[model samples]
Target: MLVISGAVQAGLAGIPGQSAELGISLTVMGSALAAAGWLLTVGWRFTRKLPKPASDIPQVEQGIRITPNIIRVVVIGAVLIVLASALFIPQVGFPDAFPILGMLVGFLWSVAAGLACTGRVMKTGRVMKNSADLYARWLSRR
Candidate 1:
């Protein structure tokens, strides 16, 4: 959605007197992208299925181990920075350049966030598969 909106905004950039419209589009798209990023990060973390413990460690001991997800943190942070920078689109001194830059930044950031999410999902899926396989092997050995 954001990518499409950015493309539309880019197309509208050639028209004169569209700075206001462009600015409005930039603001809306930026906010939407930021919100989506936040939701994606939260949803991903909340919905993630943890791999089953491979050892006989107690639940309390397992809960104390914290594995940081650096990719998610970086992606969310970049999206936020893009969102913040986007707020200045309307205030740019040159109206003509606003749309182009805004479109570029918005589109790029949206893509980055999307790819990050995809990678994380794939990684999680792989882990889940491996854990299932391990459990199946253990059952077979029983």
Candidate 2:
């Protein structure tokens, strides 16, 4: 994500005028979307390498999972993204900055908090290991 963000910043560097900035932003948006698609594809391929069940069916692995040391990163990232986006919005749109700032902050709160909590949950070895073990069992059965 940081790498992609850096690429976006590089893409937007020194572009003058709203029209130019808008075009650059669109390009960055498209590129990021494409990259997300590619990443998802890669993740799918990676999970596919595991063994399959003899029954020729895929089974879902149902379990709780957790991770640690992610909340701070997420909060920091949220603040950064919100700050960057809010800074861009007034330049991009002619609206009052307060409403935009509020909106951005609200979005940041939700996504950052959600992601951080999710990551923290996944960090718990017992939960993630159990999930992986279940998945492995299903794969082997296949």
Candidate 3:
């Protein structure tokens, strides 16, 4: 979406007096991407289950210790603020470039959120592996 919007914005720039139209279209696309990113972050966090505690599984405790959701929220919030400012401030940079900046900010925020979620999944996978090993050991003893 970001690439498509950027290409369209660039294409529109070649024409005379299409600045306003391009800005409007880019703003709409940026807003949509930002909203979608926000929703996906929320959904991802909510859907994830915290790793179960296991006395013999240090990896489980390690996995449950980090809270990436807070980091995600702060990063996304900053991106949103910047995006809004870019769209509305009217003096941050070139008048024709604000929309592109907004879209880029939104896309970056989405990427950051995805990275955070991936980190979380990796942590959980480590915890699960630890738990499985512990379980297998207990079963063998019995």
Candidate 4:
């Protein structure tokens, strides 16, 4: 969003009589297309390979371990931050402040949320792996 905002501002500022609204719309639409393309690629890769059954798949349980609470909290926080950034950017105290402040806040919130979620996922994944290994050993001995 910040990226689009900055592009729009720059584009409008560069033109002699271009409408800021028009520039903003164009930049946002272009960014949406790029984002959609990236999402498609990720979805394609994610669904391309199917895992085998648990009994035949090593470390399968590791993938199942997820912290729903932390994920939800981080997601909510990120959404709030993005929305706040978008709304506040235009109202900032100085000219040209929106591009810098808005982008910085938005990116920082996103990065922070991602890191929190990743930490939870990593911790849960490790616990799951340990449990799975212990369970497999016990079953083997039985």
TM-scores for the candidates: 0.34, 0.32, 0.35, 0.35
TM-score, structure 3 vs. true: 0.35
- What tens digits encode model 1's per-residue C-alpha lDDT throughout 1-142? 4545556565657554564465456567767887889987996667746445344334323322321244445456656755665676565555665456556555656655565566555545454435557777766786
Candidate 4 minimal-lDDT segment of 10 residues: 50-59
- lDDT by residue for model 3 over 1-142, one digit each (tens)? 4544554455555543345465456657767887888988996667755444355445544544654665566577757776687677666344556455545555556556665676677665674556767667766786
**Candidate 3 backbone collisions, by pair:** none
Candidate 4 lDDT tens digits, 5-71? 4464655444344346644664677678878889879967678463332352343434334444545
Q: In model 2, which range of ten residues has the least summed lDDT?
A: 56-65
Model 2 regions lying over 4 Å from their true place: 1-48, 51-114, 117-126, 131-136
lDDT for 80 (candidate 2) = 82
Candidate 4 stretches greater than 4 Å from native = 1-34, 37-95, 127-142
Model 2: per-residue lDDT, tens digit, 4-59? 34334444443322123433454467578878888989977677475432331121
Model 1: lDDT of residue 23: 47
TM-score, ranked from best to worst: 3, 4, 1, 2
Q: Evaluated with lDDT, which candidate comes out highest?
A: 3
Clash pairs, model 1 backbone: none
Model 2 error, position 31 (Å): 3.7
Candidate 1 contains a number of clashing pairs equal to 0
